[model samples]
Target: MDCQGQTIEVTEGQSCRDVLSQAASGKTLKKSVACTCGNRLVDLSAPVPRDCSRLEPVLADSEQGLEVLRHSAAHIMAEAVKTLFPRAKVTIGPAIDNGFYYDFDFERSFTPHDLEAIEKQMAESIAADKPFQRKIMSRDEARKFFSQQNETYKLELLDELDEDEVSLYTHNGFTDLCRGPHVPSTGFIQAFKLTSVAGAYWRGDENRPMLQRIYGTAFADRKALKSYLAHLEEAKKRDHRRLGPQLDLFSFSDEVGPGMPIFHPNGALVRTILEDFETKEHLRRGYQLVRGPQLLRRDLWEKSGHYQNYGHNMYFSEIDEQVYGLKPMNCVAHMLIYKSALRSYRDLPIRYFELGTVHRHEKSGVLHGLLRVRQFTQDDAHIICRPEQLQDEITGIITFVQDVMNIFGFAFELELSTRPEKSIGSDQDWDRATTALHQALDSMGLPYAINAGDGAFYGPKIDVKLKDALDRTWQCATIQCDFTLPHRFDLSYIGSDGEKHRPVMVHRTILGAIERFMGVLIEHYAGALPTWLSPVQAILVTVTEAQNDFARQCASELHQAGIRVQTDLRNEKLGFKVREAQLAKIPYILVIGDREVQDRGVNVRFRNKEQAGTKSLSEAIEMINEDCQEPFKRGGMRYSFSN
Candidate 1:
């Protein structure tokens, strides 16, 4: 075998090194790796069979290499935990984005002290540099061994394994049931930190025993870990659940039901601003905004195939012995609308937009403040186009998504999701839709990942995930190519050749949902919404009773100038008023006192800023007007909205 310029030959059953040594004049150097067997990376010194591909080692710095390292770190963490807590039952441990987590079913929840102790144990384990050794065993033997060892979880897991043989990993005499390609030694995990403790059901089923999940992050070096920890702290400070109530934006009530969010006046105002902006934008893009019922008969869902595919997530009701369901999606209703009229090929790209509200029965345990709510409004659209125009229509939707996301100064990544196992579409239909999505993404030259089998049951989809100020990504937009819904609803259009053909449907959303977007914004800006979306653009504060009229006049003038403004005529110190406005995240505060009234100017205080400045009332209005007009737009903008 020859690689690049190197020539190598292997004798039957000889290791890679023997061949390299014979190929090179005693110059071939040995390499190091995590594993090498069956796609498992290992040390370079490890023997490679004559049949081995014996490919060059991928360095730890490579993207794929880091994944291998992270997986090793997970094993180390599990080993440390088992060492610390002997009674704990280990389940599955896997690597995730930026880190890894392990689930353990223990008699008691792991407290903060337990986590700290676990961390210490992990550090010690890493320092010891114990080798991660793997051993294979037959299913019956493995089951018997685990049962004898009092590892009920392992026995339960082994029972589900149909394979004749399975693998086990051991570190420091603490062995776990795992199929591993872990790093050679614990010393390779130089930078790692345990992050959070959360409760999860065993195998993700609520009916199963609850397990304590411990999350941690690992990087190749200490610097990376430090930087990640800093980002985590910043993210905590900007958590929407914390900032939302502090800014008086929104709240969730137990009485209203879990996952149901109640927007305060200010929060509602922000949502209204988004709705107005998108509604106008949709009109400009030739999309007709439409309305649909929040709840419909179950029969409609049955025809759309949603009742069969996603009935579990749907909230069904029995009214007069007839079943009804709250709509979990808007595509079915939009398809019905398209079918209402006989469409011509000229109306191929019939785009319909709606701020459609939807409901899903998300598990109570996963009910987040607003991000994963059971009830939320989607900025949904459906485009019915000719088969020949599928690619163009999809590309148009991608462009529209980019333009809308730009409004909020969001940078996003894209993903293409293919068909799932339980999907409804035919093979030909799925292939065409998936191809169209891929072509659209490729045409746009956007970097994307393929989420295999992650699309909607009805179709393939392109999901756009926005990266916020903290670089955290949220799925904020989706463009789904659906053939099932159109067919189910019997949608058709007259083609150019004067023949009727089924119209291709593309379901899309610029902002996935109003409530979720607002939540994202709260976290992105740390609850300080830009002036354009602020409930009040500016607040006019009077220094004293003597300046009350002047403050009101300033506010009225600003309001007449098309700025959202209000006056705090209460007798209070200018500093107190400014502080109150800052607390509300108001963009600007105009302080008018006897001095300002006599001068016919106003003192200005920017939110979260200590310094104040004085500007002519007209000058302040101009400053605010520029800011409010581009609330969604970033750069060179300022506005104050609070009193």
Candidate 2:
């Protein structure tokens, strides 16, 4: 067998661990919890088949290997929970992206004290060095065993499976039903932590019994675990919900309803800046702006396939006893606009953009502050083009995404999501859509991964996930290739042959939801936004009321220069005013003291508390102007002040 590119002779009855321990070069058998044998993942103790031609050890540092470790950690956690509370019953535990969570049918919710005790017990189990032994049993035998153990959740899961054989793993006098590939022993879980606990429903069905969920994470070593914990700490401090209100940008009221953000003056100004910049950028790229009604007839939505596929997430009203659905998407209105015109292939690609606000009946449980809201605005657009123009349209949208994300100083990744099982389209249509997206991505040489069966109901799409300062990714942009909507709406264009040919639609969004984007921005910049994006770019402070007139004059001059300036002419001390501006995250704090008034200049301090020295009034205006325009250059766009 070839193990890690080296030839190793394996006896017929020897296990993978047995052979690898004697021949593997870099990895120890203790760290190799599993191995991939001819494309199948198996435990290290599995007997190497005679026909096996290739094998690769799964190491602790690799993603797959970490998943194995976390999976075993979940089992250890479950064992610890059972030991602490004998009445608790075990359910499913799986490794997620950052950690693992196991849901349990406990009589009461697990508290922080319970988590602490569970962690203590888990530490004991890991230190005991108990070997994790795997066993196989017949379905009937497993059922009888779990039934006698009173593990009802496992029995329910077992009853749902059709396989005759079942796998089980055990350690520290505890066993659970699971597929094999655990670490050789409990001591392998060296760097682990129990993060938090929450309530989750079994199988995500709200009608079912609720269960307590224990969340935890494990790493290959202590250093990695420490770094990850630091990142988590920083993320908590930079959470958008906390920063939004603290920065005086936005707020949410229980009386105003959830998921609807009440943007203060500052938040509104920032949002306007983003929208205005996007408008100019879109118009420069040959996009026409458009708008549609907030609610449309239910029959129109039905014809668009949204009524069937997305009805659960939509809100409906009755006017004159006719049902009208609140628009969850802007594509339907854009489709009607396309069908209203009849043209030759010359108008092949017509791009229409809208900063459209939409409403979705999001579940209360999933309603996060701004990230997952019921009402939000989208930088939405729809492009209608002939079949021949499909690839170019897709490429153009991808470029649009790249340029915009670049302007915001964000690094992004892409994924091509294919047609889902619940989607609306024929196999031929889905294939053609996927091919167009694939060809465009390949032509541009843009690296992207495929997410199978995660597309919109009407089409396949390119999902752009942008990384924030914390290295966490947010879903901000998406480019979709849609053929269903045009066909359903009977949208067509005249071809050179004088026959009506169906046009394809491309649905897209740059900054997916304005609320979510702003939330991300607040956290990305740690509430210290750029001068161009800051509502109050600078605040003028006076010394002992002597320079109040001078401060007012300076503020007015800056305001006339189109720099957002505010005046703090209060009887407060200069230090107090500066500290308030700094806490509010103003970009520039201008100090107008007696000496600064006589010199006809002001001292500037940046939000970072760095002193920028004194400059004349005109020079200060010019400096702030440059600061505002410099960010636009990141997207290669040149800006000039108003004439």
Candidate 3:
């Protein structure tokens, strides 16, 4: 017998089932192994392995298995929907990140009440424990069968398929055109939740009939599902849209169009502080900051493969009868800078960094406040290096990612994405790039998943995902090694051998996007930014108009000391001002009442809690400066005080 093109010896006249059993006992060490007998996927219990070569059992926790479970859950959901709403017509059901969604071409939009009812039906379907049965049929047979059942959406799907024979999955009297290896029964879906409802187009085409898409998430167990739900609740509470406004940080206007965020003065204060810190950090790391235009000629993108591979996601305009595209990436311009001058092997590992704003067309349905936006800034960098120096460059990037994320108190996991199916350049080049990434990860002693066929078309990549306080994972950084881009752009450097050779290019980002990171930070800190990063670190107030001068002086001193200070010299009473500041979550409240003003001191009040005693002018500055320098999680600013 031959499996995956390898020969295996089996006893003559042995039953196929027996042969498969033996094969399962001696399965290969590969991660995702799927066995096909005569090009047909089957379970190990099937009796076709005797005549089959290349038969092996797939790993249970492989990506393939997870997809199978998600897809199966979608089918179970559809079956439940049909059981509940007999008139609903199922269109499409597919697996997405950690979940599955099924769309139906129904007459009315599904309401929250409908979702609750559908969820109840789904629970009952799981309890019924119906089997997921697969059937094979010719294309004509499938089209005729679905047509007779008034499943126009299924008929449309069948028409689009190019295969001679189609596979159909059935569960509890409901059938769908599918190529699947589902869980044996509905009982396997122990945990699931109906998330939301939205309108979507058939086949994602605007011209097609609109469908009501029901989003949902499922997990292997009830505990896992509950954990996910809890994370979702936390995410909503941390949502920057709600917190940003309540905290008086940012706003969006209909006049400015959707997806473009406007930072208020307070928001700018926070962003300015972050940018200043990052600028200093980048300079210290030997990076030269550069700026580029917001839009460039489309021809440049063509050379960089952005036009070919990602043009559809870019915003384009016609100027002077020529196409100009808003920058979707910062790399091409950096490449042009490197090529502007002649270089030798001596200038081998040149690194250029940019906090560049880029524009990409994200679907409106997918856009959420700051997380998914059409325009955002990236903390991007490009490293041009020699092949021999690739590993060290990658190591440096890993360290950079670690340092930056550690500042936010996040622990991250890494994954290496290998070559994708729709890739450019030669196989040898891809192999080398992939090997270098694997070697880097191995040398760092970091455990990571090898995500096969998930890399960019140009090369392999290492993705960093951070776990939040709620145990939710968010991808925050990526390091990509590209050999094809150099070849495509004819980027070259003089070798030590005095000949031109393509330099290996590494694209790395510490923070994937600033807006998304800010959103994450809002949730991570629960809208209470640290003293060093807060929009308004302190609020100063006077007991009456008599002490307004003292309050103004206090605010000015803190501002000069690089602390964001706001003075509440409003005509309101001191208690009212203190209450307002506390409600705004300000870290510090300095009150200059008549007693403290006469004594040349200020009363200190902490937000969300009772007050500390008064301090002199010099004393207050010294304390605030110390607390701002090294903030902590103790609610109020951390200070170094002597007894």
Best by lDDT: 2
lDDT of 1: 0.81
Ranking by lDDT: 2, 1, 3
Q: Which should have the higher lDDT, number 1 or number 2?
A: 2
Q: By summed lDDT, which 10 consecutive residues of candidate 2 come out lowest? A: 634-643
Residue pairs in candidate 3 whose N, alpha carbon or C atoms collide under 3 angstroms: 2-53, 2-54, 3-54, 4-54
Score each candidate by Cα lDDT. 0.81, 0.89, 0.80
Q: Give lDDT tens digits, candidate 1, residues 274-302.
A: 88777877887799988889888999999
lDDT of 3 by residue, 1-643 (tens): 7644446577665533455554444444232223346666554334454556656555434555556667778998888788878788988899888789999977788899998998888888889888877789999999999888889889888888999999898887888988876676777677789999888888777667888999998876578779888878887887778999998887888899888888888787777666766776677777889878899999998887888888889999999999999999898888888889878999989988899999998876667887888888888898999999999999989987777776677888999998888778799999999999999999999999988999987899999999877666888799999998888878889988999988999988887888888878787788877666877778888878998888787777777766677888899866788888987888888888889978888888788667878988778777767666553333222322111
TM-scores for every predicted model: 0.90, 0.94, 0.80
List, residue by residue over 194-283, the lDDT tens digit for candidate 2.
998877778877678888889999999999999999998898888889988988889999999988899998898888988888898899
Stretches off by above 4 angstroms in model 1 are 1-40, 43-46, 346-348, 439-449, 495-499, 566-576, 608-612, 630-643
How many clashing residue pairs appear in each of the predictions shown? 16, 0, 4
| Most TM-score-accurate candidate | 2
Q: Which 10-residue window in model 1 sums to the lowest lDDT?
A: 26-35
Question: How much is 319 displaced in model 1, in angstroms?
Answer: 1.5
